[model samples]
Target: MKKLLILISILISLQVQAQRTSAPEGPGSLTFWENLSKHCGKSFEGEMLNASENDQFYGKKLVMHVRTCEDGKITVPFHVGDDHSRTWVLTMEEGNLIKLKHDHRHEDGTEDRVTQYGGLSSNTGMAKVQFFPADQETTDLIPYAATNVWWITLDDTSFTYNLRRINNNSPIIVKFDLTKEVETPPTPWGWED
Candidate 1:
């Protein structure tokens, strides 16, 4: 009976450890990623909530397509007016953190000078929100953007992408309505069929 009791306790401990590691709704969980993934393969139209006076995206048609999703990564193409030069890549890292990278390309399918600039999340953000401060790569590529911080928030009704430059008080916010699905835009630059 003593041996059997010890085995049962060991099994219970292992079970608990597994649950702790795999629970989706646990503290600092991957619920944010799961929520974002729910919209995989869908496209949504967005309105600019805020932008600077000279911003390129001002007064333009905004669209975001959740183009690709895999086990640990998602690719979203962000369209502004007729420009299809930007893609957002979200990757899950160890410890439930997510990294956001901006992949920029020219129409000729060549990478832009300021491509692949983004940062990793500091912690497992909430189910509906994740924040990524500019990483060293971004700072090195775009010196003025060293103080940039970008965040994405997703909820049942809408999803928002926002950016703030700490050094200057510049802000840009775009919100996409989840209640409606828009037509998927053409493949982003460099992602042609």
Candidate 2:
């Protein structure tokens, strides 16, 4: 009876540990990350809500693919028309922070002159929304656009990626409806076909 009791206790402890590791964090970014991972291996189409004529995303068939995911990061390729040169990278930072970076590459599998510019979340934005301000690298890369801020909102109906440029007022929003999952698009530049 004593040996059986010890074995039961050990099993219970192991189960608890497993549950704790797999459970999603709450009231902040962890929940959002887990929810975002739910759509892994899926692709969605987005439309610019307010884009200027000069915007690269303007008048293009915008598609986002959650292509690569891991324990601490997810890489999503954002396609604009035939320009498969942009990717969004989200990384888990210490202290409950989340990092967002824009990775751009060329068709010949080379890095672009302007790439890997993004920011880390400054607060626990919850499962509904997350805001990423331009990091130091972005400030150095594009001094004039240092004030760029990105806010992502996810809900049952839609997932919105909104960008606020300099002065944090001019909004360029791109939103995707969650109910409609589209066929996967082609691989982005520098990726295997």
Task: Please give the lDDT score at residue 79 for candidate 1.
Answer: 98
Q: lDDT, candidate 1, residue 138? A: 96
- The lDDT for every candidate, in the order shown, is 0.83, 0.80
Best by the TM-score measure:
1
Query: Candidate 1 overall Cα lDDT vs. reference?
Result: 0.83
Error of 2 at 185 (Å): 1.0
What TM-score would each prediction reach against the true structure? Answer: 0.84, 0.82
Q: Kindly report which residue stretches of model 2 are placed more than 4 angstroms away from their true locations once superposed.
A: 1-27, 52-54
TM-score of 1: 0.84
Across 1-193, the per-residue lDDT of candidate 2 in tens digits comes to 4554475359446544654665445656888788788888888899998688898787889888888879999888888888989889999998778899999999997999899898999987666678899999999998876988887877666778877675444477788877888888888888774
* Residue lDDT tens for model 1, 89-192: 99999888899999999999899988999999988866666789999999999988888878887768888888877644446788999999999999999985
Q: Report lDDT (Cα) of residue 13, candidate 1.
A: 65
Clashing residue pairs in all predictions, respectively, total 0, 0
